[model samples]
Target: MIRIEPRQSSSALMTYGIPVLSAIISLLLASIPLTFSGAPIGASYFEMFKGVFGSKFAFSEMLTRATPLIFTGLAVALAFRARLWNIGAEGQLYLGAMAAVAVGTGVFDVPGVILIPMIMVMGCVAGATGMAVPTLLKTKFGADEVVTTLLLNFIILIFLQYMLEGPFKDPMGLGWPQSSPILDQGMLPPLMDRMRIHSGLIIALICAITAQFMLARSVWGLKLRAIGENPSAARHAGIRVNRTLMSAAIISGALAGMAGVSEVAGLKGYLTSDLSPGFGYTGIVVAMLAGLSPLGVVAAAIFIASVFVGADSMSRAMGVSSYLADLVVSTSLLCVLVGGFVARFKFVRLIQKKEVTQ
Candidate 1:
């Protein structure tokens, strides 16, 4: 018979090293398919590497793709850390995008300074509103937040599709579902001329830094952490668990909302059904892999973004399917989950000796 024993908290090395190791594993797994597909696996890998990290332009694209993930990952990480199941980031993203579209289309005459902030604020408000339903149901009716939130994702997706296909559809385009291009005033200013990279990257970095500061050095952070560890204890300590959870949900929703705004105002320049490249869902993996740390989320975002950029190049250069990249990302997330569990709780064999006489 085998016995299990609890392991000690993980070391710093284990915490950081697991993700790197998992990346190597994911890459190896990805390579197997490339070889089988009659592709030059080595050259494909080289192309991917170069596509993401070789030139300034390639690096900029990586950062551009990472901007939204950073916010979405932070959103998931913050809520999860607070023990709040906020699986509706996708819906929240949609709400934000919708709100941005409203601002962009209806208030095109506003000055840039005013328009940009107005769009972002509206997006955040919409995201909070989208989160309200699940939060209220969880708090009042004892509904499972996970189920409610997940269901809401589909609801919001359908809503977005309807709007894009009906009311928001551009009149000039021949019925292809899409919104009018966001007004120039509301569009995110370019971070570098002629690059798709925008101020959204700066916003993501700021949000990450602020989240890190909040979690590490604020009174609210202490209460959140306490509640996350033990809600009963937190209540006994006079830290209102319900209130803290609600606040966390709002923050999470707002972060996801910012991702929507970034995608619309910074990248797409309009709201569309495919606004997100599943960034909201991918955020869960990023948050888990990062151990829910803000700094770690930044690193994870970059890692995932690099893989995506590399995958595009791999497809073009070696005729490999980009879907393989998604597989690798999913596999990496699974490995990280297992690694974290092992690092946090180890199993050791326990032996028992009994006297022969007994």
Candidate 2:
């Protein structure tokens, strides 16, 4: 007989080491696809590395790609910590983007100093509202947030399409389905003159640091954490479970909304359906890979971003399909899950006597 048993005292080293070990294992696994593609695994991998880190331009692009991920990852991590299961960050991101375009365009006529902050605040509000509806449904009507939030993503996408093609459509786009351009004052300035890396990177880093600190140190965080572990016990201990969950959901939605603002105001200078190439969904992967740790989310997001960016370059140079990058990333998640299992549990083979009657 064999049994799997969890280790009562898993070491800190094993906790951190699993992600690193799994990452290496995942890379090794990626070579299989390269072989099937008839590409030289070593050369392809080398090209990928160069694409990710060889030049300043490559590094900047990787960070830029990671910017939205950081926000959405933090959002997911925070919501999961509260057991809210806020799965609508993608929809919330679109809400934020739409709000940004609505406010940042010439409608406000405010100075850059004021317009920028206003746009950000409105974006956060829009995101919060997006999440709040589903949360409210869950709390008041016994609706499952997972279903409501998941469905909301589609609804928000349809709504966004209508806004872009109808009210907010730019006349100068020449029939393109894109929102009006954001004013110059509302644009997020790039860190360097020629690089696309913008202040949104700084904003993302700040949010991650703040989330980590609060999750570790704050009283509200403690309550949310407690609720995540056991809602009934937490309630018996005098924690207002519903209120805590609501607040956490709002915060999560706000963080996700910031991701939208980063893309539209910081990178694209306008809202569009493609503002997020599933960044919201990808954020879930980032949060899971980070083990729901806010600080860990930053590293995970950057790593995932580097993979995609490098994969693009690799695909172009190696004549391989870009879909391989998705395979590699999804494989990384699976490896991490297996590594986590290994870190926490061990299999034991037990001696058994044969049945004498048989």
Candidate 3:
């Protein structure tokens, strides 16, 4: 017989060591797929590394790819810290993009100093409003947030499609379903002369740092953590559990919304149906890989982004499917989840004496 028992206290070494071990194991497992596909596993990995960091241009593109991920990862991380399962970040992101596009396309005609901040604020508000629905359902009516949040994603996607195809469709796009290009004043300025990397990277970094500080040093963060650990206990201790959960949900949505804002204003210059290649979903993996730490999210996002970017290069060079990158990421996530489980519990084997029958 086998039994699983909870650890009296989680080991600090295992807490950090598991993630690294999981990543290495994921890589090893991924090579099996490559082997079956008849690709040179070692060379393919080398190419992937070279593609991401071999030159300044590649590194810059990696940063660009990581920027929105950082935001969404932080969004997921913050909410998860409070035990809020907010699966609606994708929806919030689209709503935010819609709001920013609304402001950029002549809804606001202020200078860059005013227009930029206005767009960001509007985006954040839109995201928060989207999150409020699920949070409200959970708090007021005892609804399951996981279901509500997931369903809301489809609703927001449909709404975004309507906006692009109807009201906000760019007439000059010659039938493309996209919003008009954002005004220069509302756009995020490029961080380098030749690279597409923009000020959004800085914004993401700042938010991560701020989140880290809040989680580590603030009384509010302490209360939120307490609520996450045990809501009944927290309520008994005079904490407003619902209110704190709501706040966490709103903040999570707002951060996700900023990801959409960054994508349109910083990279795409316009809102489109396919603005995100699943960045919102990918952010969940990033947060999990980071063990829900805000600062660790940055590194995790970069690593994940590099995998995608490098896999594209490897695909072109080796004739493998580009989707192999996604497989690698998914495999890594599974490994991390299993690792976390192992870290939290110990497996024990029990043997029964046969002498009882004798």
TM-score of each: 0.95, 0.95, 0.94
Which prediction has the highest TM-score against the true structure?
A: 2
Top lDDT model: 2
Q: Compose the digit string of candidate 2's lDDT tens values, residues 209-287.
A: 9999899999998998999999999999999988998999889999999999999999999888888988898888788
- Model 3 accuracy (lDDT, Cα): 0.91
Candidates' lDDT values, in order? Answer: 0.88, 0.91, 0.91
Model 2: weakest 10-residue lDDT segment is 19-28
Q: On residues 1-358, what C-alpha lDDT tens digit does candidate 1 reach at each position?
A: 5655566667888889888888778888887878878888789889999989889999999999999899889989998998888888888999999999988875567888999999999999888877777888888899999999999999999999999988788887677899988888789999998899999999999999999999999999899899889999999999988888888888899999999999999998978788887898889888987889998999999999999998998788778888877887898898888787767776766677875994
**Pick by TM-score: 1 or 2, better one:** 2
In model 1, residue pairs whose N, Cα or C atoms come closer than 3 Å (at least 3 residues apart or on different chains), thus clashing, are 7-346
Question: Order the candidates by TM-score, highest first — what do you get?
Answer: 2, 1, 3
Worst 10 residues of 1 by lDDT: 1-10
- Candidate 2 Cα deviation (angstroms), residue 340: 2.4
Ranking by lDDT: 2, 3, 1
